[model samples]
Target: MSRFDENKFRAVTWVQRHIANPLTRRLPFQTVLETTGRKSGLPRRTPVGGRRIGREFWLVSEYGEKSQYVRNIQADPRVRVRIMGKWHTGTAHLVPEDDARARLKSLPRLNSAAVRAVGTNLLTVRVDLTD
Candidate 1:
């Protein structure tokens, strides 16, 4: 990555981690994805924006594999997602073959707009709800 991209990534992630995420994750209506910490072996919940379709939940990760939650998913695919105050268990899958930009078009507008604006390596993740 170029210096500019690296710097941008650090800046954006820092804001999300320390500021935006902490606030958003507390919202009762915010969609949350709970993944096992890759190394910590504890549950890590992150605020995410996605749409549920049938038995699946689709979302775009702005930072791809670099995102902490994405790395957690890579380590353990099993996850729990809270949507509209209800929790659902699922397995997360990273779909590199999917067109993330096109997928974003079908998601919630406000979040998609932000993702598109700040995302460095857009990646599509599909979670198949088990219950």
Candidate 2:
């Protein structure tokens, strides 16, 4: 799986720049989900790449099903996914589409120098936008 991540490092940097940085963050690309921790019930925030599907916003888990966000979704479907400054509330779903699967396979590579590079093959989980 990692062999496919030619730019795992660069991709991580891109993700951090888009998701972690405060000034340059934007939506439908660099987004964060503010949700409650399942066990602690405390607020937990996770950065994610989101897609717009029709009138509703959509999100996919590019990392895997074991991610904390996935667990959070299972615990409580109610969630707020933030993109850029604007945001939307939504529920998580498993869309199970070929395009989504292809997108997962086509993730941009990370630069070799970027710290904390990623290599694991991620799974996509779709998010259904809510009012």
Best by lDDT: 1
Write the residue-wise lDDT of candidate 2 on 1-131 in tens digits: 45455466356547655666444343355567776789999867776555555645555454455457677877887778775566778777655453554554334323211111253434456667775
Work out the TM-score per prediction. Answer: 0.98, 0.60
Q: For candidate 1, list the clashing residue pairs, or say none.
A: none
Q: Model 1, 23-76: lDDT tens per residue? A: 999999999999999899999999999999999999999989999999999999
Best by TM-score: 1
**Model 1 worst lDDT window (10 residues):** 1-10
Local accuracy by lDDT, each model = 0.97, 0.58
TM-score of 1: 0.98
Residue 75 of model 1 has an lDDT of 98
